[model samples]
Each structure stands twice: as structure tokens, then as C-alpha cells.
Target: MFLLKVFFLLLQVVTVAVYSRADIPPPPEPEPIEIIELPLPPVASAVEGSCTSGTGCILQHAGLVQGGSFLPDGNHVIARVNYTGAPAAPDPASVYTGDQIILVKADGSSFSNGSPFKCITCGVPQDSSQGKTEALDYPQAFRDGRRILAGTNIIDCGEFDLVSDECTPESTFIHPIRWNTAVDGSGEGGSIRELRLHPDNLHIGFNSFTYDAGKLNQYAYTGRLALNSAPTTGLPMAPRYDLTNVNVLSNNDTRNIPLIVDRDQIRINTDAITVGEFRGFSGSGKEATYIGYPRESSNIDVFAVDLATGDVRRLTSHPEYCDPIDISADDEWMAIMDTRGSNRQMFMAGMRNVPPLTDIISTTATSSTRNNGQRRFFQPYLLDHYGDRDDYYGQQVNAAGDGSPGSINDPQWNGMADPRFSLDVTRLVYWQALVVSPACGGENPLPCPNSTEPGGRTERLMVAHFTSRQPVPVTDIEPLSDTISWGTPYEPGTVPSRELFISGGVYTLYGTANGSAQVTIVENGDAIETVAVTYESYSDDGLTFLDGTENITVRNPTVTLNEVDWYSDLTQRGQTNATKKTSPDGFHLSIDVNTNIFNANGTLSTTVNGTLYTQPANGT
Candidate 1:
């Protein structure tokens, strides 16, 4: 019975397995493998050679171009290309291409002239447009013409029509537009009227306006967008001017009427108004200008708006044409490009004198006198100005100050003129338009020196100090590569152990300096003795304050400002790196304390607890 049951089970298994195998049919011999094809990707390459319209040369890359210019700050150069071959305006549907202009720095790094290149970084392609071009007329220094404003926006080429419909039906295609520019690091962009960057609040003069009917007959105004003590305060301060019926007669007789608008003052209930004097009045306090062709017209005026008092001041009223004008903090000085004729010059005026404030101190039992420094006022000096020659306004020619007769290379014709000073009043720069003689008339005869003569500009950067004072070279400051290692003076060959990781001392318990320094103290609680181990060197001397104390304590904490003393004996000049050390209780100190303690004689001294310590004539 067991054998029969096993046989039945085996037969059933064999039947089921064979039925499944027969239906599979050996997996159909794996089928003859089939192969499929894929489409190829499009390849791209740069346009190899330059092509002009009607040449029938198709480039790997081509397009119509719109115009392009270097941004005012000269940061990034952009080249815009419109496929439309003509000078026609942008049709919203036209295709355009843009390329970023990049510059390689002295450090071997490349930066964009502006926009996507600054702050952020990127790799750029090399092309012929990367070099300088002579076709562009860029901004030159107001004085030193040779300085050749470093970062200039230059546009070299432009492309026209690319689309068949946009191009004239019978005409062919032209290339695209390309531009190059350099942006100065000084530019900061925001859609505001004023800028107050710390340490460099007035770096780029914007936010202020100038109006001049004539000297003193004119008034100047600046936007005090942020007033002291009150963030809620608005515009229009004292010394207001109403621009009603005001007119300026330029030497060239060109007249401009400004448009004015009034808006609600943010701080007060009244409305603050700004005259629509210029075309591009983006609230960002940046200056803009348009120079007259060949000669600049100095006819200019600015309306000042008071946010708080709804007042307007017409800053100036002068017959001469004015171009560049800059105002100072506290509304004290007004600097401008004054155009008289042969005397196209720069001028400054003192507006107001700052005052000193005093506060009384009366104790319960006694009274003492505590005087803070009084504010001193200075009279404004007239800077360089070049006026018109003969009857021609804005014609470059030599002029004199106070109507004195100054000789040009030939005073009768065009010569030394257009002097502009640096903001610090340290250097005077002037422009001399020269008519170069052509050698083509042989070295002998030129074309009678006509107005078409190639005119050149000159600028000079001078070191100007006060009268009887020699100009100092404050630039090109070199850094000190090596300084003496400092710490507690130690005995020769005695490897001193420090409770702190690196620095340790045993003589003084005066005080300690706080910072990222590691420190440790050890004492037997017996000696009240004091030991001062200081490493001294000659440095531009500064001041440190301290309070009286018997314990090894630090008293007054001293802060160092960059105010330099010309008399200091510190060998190195210009900006220098400085470091200091003081005690934990605020009494001990170490510094470049020996250099300029005396402002007159350049003497060397170190002050400790109100007592000046004189170092040997030549520091040890």
C-alpha cells in the first residue's frame, strides 16, 4: 500500500511539471536581440571670424544688438546684442544677447566690471575686446589728468539687425552689439536719495543739491535724511531759499527750467518738496552729469528740500557755467567746478562755523571747572578757477586768480586752464587743451592750427599742505614685515615655564590684558612688590588714560584713533598695524608709546599713571 501511494504521488508531480515545461517552450530561444538608435545632441562653438552685413558669411553664433554703455561706476562692461540688423528700437518680441565684461587684476584674478562679477566671482573667456580702446572718451580727473580714472566704461562695437522681418525686406543682416566697462569699488547701489556708509559716509557725493545765482547771492542745500537724536525728523533745515522766479543767465545763453514736486514729509504734518531739476533723479544719492560737446556748459542749479520745514533753497546764482559741485558735512563748504572762461576752475566756500557746547558741574560741597575743547571755525579759501577766453564760453584758456595776468605757453591763445583740486585740498589738477601740430605738413608747416586740431588734456596731482609747510607723501605706505617678539623679559638661556601655555612671568602682579590670550597667575601671598617688564619701540605716539590705584591694577583704558602726528619719530609712515596690552584691572600698558608724545619736537615718551617716562633720545 505504501509503494502504490508513493507511485501515485510521483506520477501526479511528473504530470504537473511536464505540463508547465511544455507551455513555456524553452523560453522561445531567448529571441534574436534587437538594437535601437538614439538621436544626436546639437553641438555648439563660438563664431570664428568677424563679419559685416551683406557679406553672406553665416557665423556659428550671431544676433541683432541693442546699444550698450559702461555703467557709471565702471564695474561691469556689458555687451547687448539684438538680432535686428538696424538701429531701430527694441520691439518687445526681438531676441537679444548679453555678455559680461571682465578684467584681470594685478593679483591674477579676474573681476566683472559690475553686476554679476563684483562680490561674487566667475571664470571669463578671453577675447580681443578685453584690451583697451581709443575710441571712447571716459571721465578724467578733475585736476590730475594723467591719473586717467582707473576703471572706465568703454563701448567699442555695436551690432544691428538679425531678424529677417525686423531688417529691411530688401536689405541683409548686420552683427550684434558688444560693450565693455569697469566698475569702481566705491559704488554701492540702493534706490535711496542719500547714503551714509560708516567711515565713508560721503564717499560718492550724492543726496545734496546746489543752487547759485551768484556768490553769496546763491544758497546750497543737502538732504539731511537722517537727523541727529530723532530718526523721525524730516527734511529742510535752516537757511532756506525759495526758487520762485529765479533765473540763471549762462555765459553761453542756454536756459533750463526745472520741474518741482512736493510730497508729504515722513516726520511732520507738512509736505516736503524736491524740484525736478535733473533728468535721472534716482533717490540713490549718486551724482550724474551731461557735458556739452567739445566745451562744457557750467549753467547749473540745484533746489534743496527741507523735510521738516517745507522750505526750498536755490543754492547758487552765478553767470559762469558750473559742472561738478560737492558739499561737506554740516553744510559748511561748497566745492564746485566754476566756469568763467579761460578760468574753468574749482571753488570752495565756507557756509557756517560749528560751535562748542558747555555743561555745568556743581557738586554738593564744591564746584570745579571742566572745559571741553571749543569748536573753532575756519574761513573758506578760493581755490583754482579758469574762466572764458575772449567771447567764447567754455573755450580752454589760461586764467588768473583775482584777475591777475598769468602767462600761458602763449596767453593770447589756448594754454593752462581748468584746474580742479582733490577733495582733501592737498593737490591741484588742471586741464590744458593743446592743439598738436601735424608732421604731415612736414615738420615745417601745419594747418594754421585750426579748431579741428587734435586737442589733448593734462592733469597734475600735487602734494599741497598749508603755507610754509612741505607736502607729505601719505600714500605708498609700506608695511613692516618684522617686529621684535614681545613678552616678559627673560634671563638668557633660562627656559622659563609658563602656567599659561606660552607666556609666563614672576616679577609683577600689576594687572592683565584681556582678549583671546591665555593667562595664569601664581603668588605666595607674601610680597606686595611690583615689577614692570615691557618691550618698547618707536611708534607714532598716542594717549592712554588711567585711574589711581595702589594694587597692581589697570586704571584708564586708552583707545587709539588713526589721527597721525607728523612730528612722531616712527620711521614708518602711512597707515600701520597696531597692537596693545593692558592689565586685567586696567592699569598696565604697552604700545608704540615713544614716537609722538610731543606734537612739536617729535620727542619720544611713554606715560604711566599720568607720569611721562622719557626714553633715551634714540630709543634703546
Candidate 2:
């Protein structure tokens, strides 16, 4: 599916409407609970090679559903399952038990080369004492598929053994602890929870941290590796999620959180190892934060983290929101999904500080265009497909640097959002789930569903077309039942070149041989002049007057010369006239000249050299 559509869905979850009016009811509050840190479970063997290491995966019929996501490398993909909950479990012939995270290549190729993407049971090992229904619902088998960071759920808490690649019943997933348990002082207040991890997956995001779920706190606390002793003050929150954005720099004593906030007013929960905390995050993976109506105003802040000093230096501060920001394999250009206006257009910004040259590429599902008095503008807007299917709103709002559109006559974005250049970003070669509203496109916008039971829709890969510049339409036509997506361009420099002409002609070299004379000419030369010459010659064949008068400068003319040398011979052919010119002086004649002496030049000129022309022998 298209990358823009998937981003729209992610924004939806964060931008749930909360009316500020007193007459309106407050947003639903998260339930409260306890805070208990559990030790990671022991590793279990794969039943003596029962788990054959698969080479690849092939997906039959699956597509983007919701909570769309891509792999760390942006090459592999993980999407929400399209099929709803499986039939009541405990049946003798059930293919799956708990939630299964479907893994597939962006092209739907299988790990074993030819086989389709097969599902793996991630359910935790069931306890025999527990009923069969409960046995099938193991935590290990329930793959969240959405918030996968470093191959684990973002919410699963605690530090697991980084050595073995084995997962067990005790293996924690993303944010494994219930939200209520993360509260600090009993009853209801939220705690500054820290989700730390050994930095193995740096590509997904350098280090990420979000404020507590319920409240927008004044302080944003993060844990990082430091040389100083643990914090003596502030709320103490331990690592409660499996997927950590902070890197355990040098045994967790010195870690780094690459965050960029307007002010250093945020707090760091030094009690636990947290990487970094930024006010905004948007670019794919990196540090992304989208908070608004549908969370469309997300931004990714790039910064450097000092493991020892805990210093943060801002690397990128482009006001536009970019998703899946990536440096080219060469690291010259950085590719990102710039959600500057209504569309999640792909853009590339120069790392240098000279204003950052940027180019827009595609439009997100929620992108919009607008009209001013005499001019028109496009701001960040989304199709409101909430509640009723047809209730889609296409209002335009400026996603200004302050995270809000200021005015309709926003001249700062005159030609800024115009998609005139190709994006410099490249997507991973993996397929992920992409959600689309019916208001945007009816039925399947990318892949056509087969209407079959499980294998209904064709798997849609989320490829980043980093080089493409054209706006790929998200039309739900045939073949694509409902799932429709476009890949970023793989070939760069595909932008069509405008044609201009300089008056010119085709040039060719020519060589000519006449009797004992030969000449060569370069049909085209840089000289701007044309010259013509006439020459006389004698032939030993007694045909001296043959075509004696010919134009020297004819179009594509071929000039030849034949100089003859007659020898005194007394022999006769059919009774020779021996009496008249007997003993006539045997004259030696030769033509030594350069072919370039006579050349033609229209608007341009060419030269023909005759240094090779020779007349050695004529008669015996």
C-alpha cells in the first residue's frame, strides 16, 4: 500500500478528538494498576531443529489492514492481519492459536525462496493445567505486528538476554506491563516509565520516548547511560517496554538519548536507562511524534547523543515532517516523507546548513489543496472518514513550523510544497499493512481481493520510491480489490529533460581512389569557411578528356585526380603509328596535393586531407 495512506492511519490513533468545551465529556482515562518488574524467562530450545531456519518467505493472499509498519531496514515489511480474529480456538483442526505476526518480503517472496509466507505461532507455551482454550493463547504467539522495534513489540518491558536468539513464554513483548501498572504513587497518577534496550536496532529509531499515556506532563523524563550515580530525586520509573529507543552505551552507565526539544525543561528519569526524548518525531523510524487531529502534524527530529556527557546536538531541524528519514547508501542525501501540506510528499534535504534545498514528491492520503483570493495553496488536511463512510472532510490547514497553519496567505509555502523534484528516499523491500478510508478510494485501493476465505487479498508491499516525482494516484480499480499502493522510484534521474536544439548537421568522413591517386577527407570540421578548386589531369588509358569539366564544390562531391607517366616503347597494337612520336621524351608526371585545400563550410565547415593521394605508375 502507499506509504502516505499508512501514515494517515498512524495519525488517527494519536489524534483522537478531545473537546475542550465544558459541556463536552472528557476523554476516556486509562485504567489504573500496580508496578511489578518481572525477570525475563529462561530460553527454550527449538525442539532439536524443529524450527528449521527458513531462507525467505512467500505471501499468498494478504494485504495492508491497519497500524501499517515496515522493517528496520525499510526492506522487509510487517502489517496488521487483514483477517479478523480466528474461529473459536481449541478446535482439533485449527491452523493458528494466538495473534500471529505475518512476516513477508516487500515483494511477497518466501524465506524458502519458493514457498509463500507461512505463519508462525508466537503464542506463549500453554500450561497443561490450564484449559485447551487457554493453552492456545500463549503470549509468545500473540504478535502485535504494529509496534515492532528491533524484532520485538514496543510495549514489552524489561531487558532480555541479548545473547541467545530464542524467545520463551516469559519473553516480554512491547509495553508488556499494563498501562495502569506504570503509575508511580499508587491509585491513579502516571509514572515516568522508561523503556530501555541494548541498542541493536538503531535504524528503526536512534532512541525514542513518549510522555505518559493519560497526561501531557510538563516534564519529559528519559533514561540514558551516564557516568554519574543513579538519580536521587524525581519520579523513578523502570524500563517497562521490550522495545527500547535508548542505547545501553558502555554497560548502561553511559547511554545516549538523541532528542531535540525547544527547551531543556524536560526531566530525565535517571533511575532507569532511557535513550532520549524529543518534542516531535515523524520521519520513518527515527524520533517521530504526531499529536493532533489524526496526528498529521508529526515531525522527526535528528540529533546526536553523547554517551558520556549526555549532550544533544540538533542535526536536522526542517520544519516539515518527514517519515522514514534515511541517508542514502552514500549518505550524501537524506530521504524523508515531508508532510508539509495535505500530502505526505517525499522530500530530500541537504545536511548542510545553507537553507536545506528540498524537493517534494508524493501526496499522502490526507493531503489537501486550497484556493486563496487570486492564488491557491495546499496545507495539511485529511479526508474525515470518521463514523459515516461518506462523511469525509477535505479542509486545509497549514502545518507551520509551530505545528499549526497560521494564515491562508502563507507566502512561506508559495512554491515550497510544489512537487517539482524527485524524492531522494528509498523504501525497504518489504510489504506492510496500509489502511485506506472508503472516502479516499472505494473497495481496495491497491490489491483486489479474491473473495476467498483466508487468502482473499493479494499481499501489498510498502516500497519506498525514493526517486519517483510523479503523484501516484490511489485509485481502487480492478485487480486491486481494495489495497492499493505505489512504490518509491528505484531509478534516480528519471525526471524528463526539457529539449532544446542548436542548429547543426550530420558529418561523415569519406575517402576516394582514382587510378593511381587516392584521397581522404573529414566530412565535418570546425572551420567556418568553404573553398572550391578545379584540377586537370591526364590518363594513361588514352581517355584523357573523360569528364574534364566538373564542379568542384558539388553537394557531397567526390573529386579524383589521375596523372599519367608514359614510357617510350616500340611495340605496336594493331599497327601502331610508330613514325610520329618515336622516342618521345618519357615524361614522369605526379599530382602532390592536400585534399583539405578544397573544402566546403555552410554554417559549419569540414576538411578532407589529400596527403595520401599518389600516382606512382601509368605505362610500361
Candidate 3:
């Protein structure tokens, strides 16, 4: 009789819809934001471009794939290159010898000019005066994947023959890792950024940036790395590497929450696991991925929490600009590094659910436009742990959006920061650079193209191979029999195609590669096995947790693993401005199930929340 009624707010009243520094929401009247079209994710690419060396088609090239990791015999990749053409000992101009730490042969196999790569920090005192300055930036491979932690150094140059993946830079040495920070000796020191190493290979998860009071703090730590028997009391002679039990994953604390409908109106949760920045962990380390805080306005997404259970999961939701990520080792899938299609933050996340106001104060001038300086408009998507809902946005590992200058999705060839996943998840290792000069060559009206790769070198090295093992989200009547898609974007992070579970009982809960839209698991009506979610509470008990601006998977999902997707912008009953071709018209999907705090050690979460309401008609 009312024709329409919809409201899914976590409280826009006293202001608790998220966007921090404290809270911001005040500018709305300007309007023009609406880019949304983003596509390319079903899977196709096989080898991809920009993998220079001699240009022989199958990986085995070197120099241009900085920062990579994925070696437990899934072929190979442990990069951090520099070498921009200068072999015969030529340009000792301290080009830093291009900051070596090589080895790339992502198993496409079949090449041999005598160098598939094997130069651990290349030429360091390892021999022949081949030293100019070894810089090694983001390497990671330990768990006997053959030693390495990079940038607190710790490398091992020989005897690493994973069946000739090769190694032996004449015995290199670059140890450095003594960061005390304060064990109580008055404290005075700091410096660390994105250095993760915790798959229990002995704890470690870093990221620090201090300045408190004057503001500018972005912490997220977890420590345990000791090798000191002596010598690090202040660096006697630089004995190196010592940090113990540090812990700080949610001590910035700030909860208040109380408005399920003006229960008096409170809402503060501030930032516990709702994290504003801290991106690493979760290969089963239990979950900690971060960068969330501006859920609507500035939009920058990517979240994942649940280190023992503070549970939150919002992993990337378009809005352009996603920060490098990885998560796949029997945990479903994810490989992020997005800028969507480089429409770059779409003015301020393309007006989706609106209400972020000036982001209060510009949110860093609107997330620094994703990149213009450090060059990173990013491009590398591959989701499915229930991330990116409704129309299903994922699958662009390098489909060659082809801006051409060097291919492989080359939008200027950006994309960097920890894009790894290999230990049988198939393969996906990354690196790319090439916008060049002061941000863009010469006179800078936006020139810089030139280097078409054969060592003309600006940065390259990417490997994407596929097979299939995570896609299953059916219902075209009963569609999902297998689903497994062949991998692409660029290729090689194998397990090529997947999408299983969900049939007789139904509990399926995901379906949108093209099948339209589906999200099941309703019980008495059908489908059931498990579904206990608590992701930062909205409370309804029994367990299903997800509402308001809802984030649909990018990674960090666990009720055991994946399935909490809910996009809900709801509003269409004769629509006003045609919200995405007539969104739900009056849709309220709460599907209740979840009961108070599950694990800070309390241990208890088993999900089944249900209560669906759909009224389609208007745009359809």
C-alpha cells in the first residue's frame, strides 16, 4: 500500500557510516560523479606481454619484476630486479647495478641463453667486483622456499636448486634486520613499510608511520623474529634482526555502538578491525588484510580482519583504486591491484551510495588520484572469495586492455605492490613499471612511451597461467555442475578455474559472472550447511552479518570461508533517477543470524541468519 519503503542505514544520524580521522560528511550538491561500466573478467589471456630479456615468449627473463614471491615449487618467482642493460661490467656508474635479487622462470619453461636467472642480489661481494649497490626491496620466500625476507635483508645465495630454479651468486651477504624501536631503553628509532612474513614461518607483519598528536600514524604490527644471541643492544657491530612478540592489531580501540534505530543514537566503533591501513596476512594466518576507512565517500576499499576474530571483510568494491593484494592457498581466491580501468577513483568513487561529503576534508585530496607520481594506476584483478557483488567485478589479470607501448594491460604499465599467490593455487606473480620521467617523460604534457621492452627496459615481468578451482556460484535453474574457468588477465597462478559446492541442499550463495544474480542459503525454504558471520556486528543473532553499504568479497570471508556478499543500495519502486537500471525498487535483505562477539578468544561462530525480502519490478 505504501508503494515503497527502504532504508538500510548503520546510522547516518549521529554519523557512523565510516570515513575517518574522526568523521566527515558535509558536501553534497555538486553532483556529476557516475562513471560505472567496469568490465572484463571472465578469463582468457595466456602469456601476456612485457617480459623482456631476449623476448623468447616463455618466461625466464630478468630485470623489471620488482618485488615478488611464490616458490614452494610452483615453478618459480622470487624477484626484485633492477638491471637496465649493462652486463659486461659496463656501466659501473653505480647504477646500483639495477638493484638485483633475481630469478624468474614462472614455469612456462623452454628457454636457454644461459640465464633463466639466478643472481641473488647479483654480483654483490659474491664475486668479480660485481658490486655497485644491492637494493633489494620486496622479496619474500622462506619456509624453505629457499631463504629470503628482503628489506631487513636476510638472503641466502647458494644451494637452492628447486630442480634448477638455480641459485649461487658466489655466496652473497646482505643481512640487516635490527630494529629495536623500544624494549624500554628510552626508545628512539623507526622505519618500516609493508614487510610481511608470517605464515607461521615465525611471526612478522609490519607497517609503521608515526607522528601522533601532530597526527599521521598508521600502525599495524605483529612481531617475533629473533636471531640475537648478542650484539644488538644498540648494534654493537650490527648483529641484526631482533623483535619479539610486539603485537598491536587492534589497540587503537574506540567502540560505542547503540543505534539499531536510535537506541539513543551512538555508533563509534572507531577503528578496531575496521582498519584504516594495514594490508597483509591471510593465507590462513587467520586474516588481517586492510586499508578500509572511507567506505562511501573516498571509497578506497580492501579489508579483511579476524585475527582470532574481530571479523570484518570488505575486500575491494570497485570505486577504483585498490591496493596490491593476494590470498589463495586453499582459501578460495584473490589477487587484487586495481584502479578498475584507470578511470582513476572515478572522481571520488563514482557516486554509488553517496554520503561521504567532502570526505570531510578531501581524504588526501581524494586518495591522491591513485597515481601520478609513484606511478600506479594498478591493474590486476582476480576475485572470488565472494568479492565484488551484483554484476560481479573481477577477472582482469592482464587481458591486455592494450594501451600498447609494452602491452600486458599497459595503461602506462603501472601495477605494483605484493601481488603473489603460488603454492598450488596455480600462479600469479607480478611487477610492472613504465610511465617514466618526472612521472611522464620530457616536456610532460604526457609523453613517455618509447621502450617497447627488449631491455630498453623500464620495468617488466609478469606471469599468469591458469587452470581452475574457484568459481562455483550457480543457479540458472540448476547450473553449477563444475564452473571452473580458465585463468587470464595475463595468466599463471594456476588452479585455472573453479566454482564448486551448492546443489541439492542449495546453500550456494553466489552467482553473477553472468547468470544474473543469486545469493542463496535460506533453510526451511532450501539450501543449508553453514553460515555464521559476525563481521563487526549489526546484531540480529543466529548469524549472517552484512548490511548497509555491504561489501561483496575481495578476500577475508570465513564463516569457515567465503559467502557474505550483500551490495544493497536498495531504492527503486518507481525509481527516481534510475539507480543502475532500477535497483531493487524496495529491497530489504537482512537474512539474520549472528550473536555477539565471537572470538577475541571467546570462540563461537557458526552462522545461519535468514530473512529475505525482494520486490522486483521497475527497471526489469
lDDT of 1 by residue, 1-620 (tens): 00000000000000001122233222111112111111111112233222222211111222211111222222212222212221112431111112222111111233332212221001111232232222212122211111111122212111311111222212321111111011221111111122111112211111212212110011111221111221121121111111111111111111111111122101111121222212111122222211111110112332333222223333333323333333321122233333333211111001000000000000100000000011001111122121122222321212222322212322212212122223333322222222232311234233223322111111111111123223332222121111111111212222222111111232221212211111121222321112122222212122221112111211112221112111111111123222222223332122221121111123223222333333221111
Ranking by TM-score: 3, 2, 1
Query: What's the true lDDT of residue 372 in model 3?
Result: 56
Q: What is the lDDT of residue 136 in candidate 2?
A: 13
lDDT, residue 115, candidate 3: 46
Q: What's the CA RMSD of model 1 in angstroms?
A: 36.4
Q: Give the Cα lDDT of each candidate.
A: 0.19, 0.22, 0.46
C-alpha lDDT of residue 392 in model 3 = 65
lDDT of 2 by residue, 339-446 (tens): 344222111111111100000001111121111111122222311111101122222222223432212223222211111111122332222221212211344233
Cand. 2 Cα-lDDT: 0.22
Judging by TM-score, tell me the better candidate of 2 and 3. Answer: 3
> On a 0 to 1 TM-score scale, where does candidate 2 land against the true structure?
0.30
All candidates in order of lDDT, best leading: 3, 2, 1
Backbone steric clashes in candidate 1, count: 81
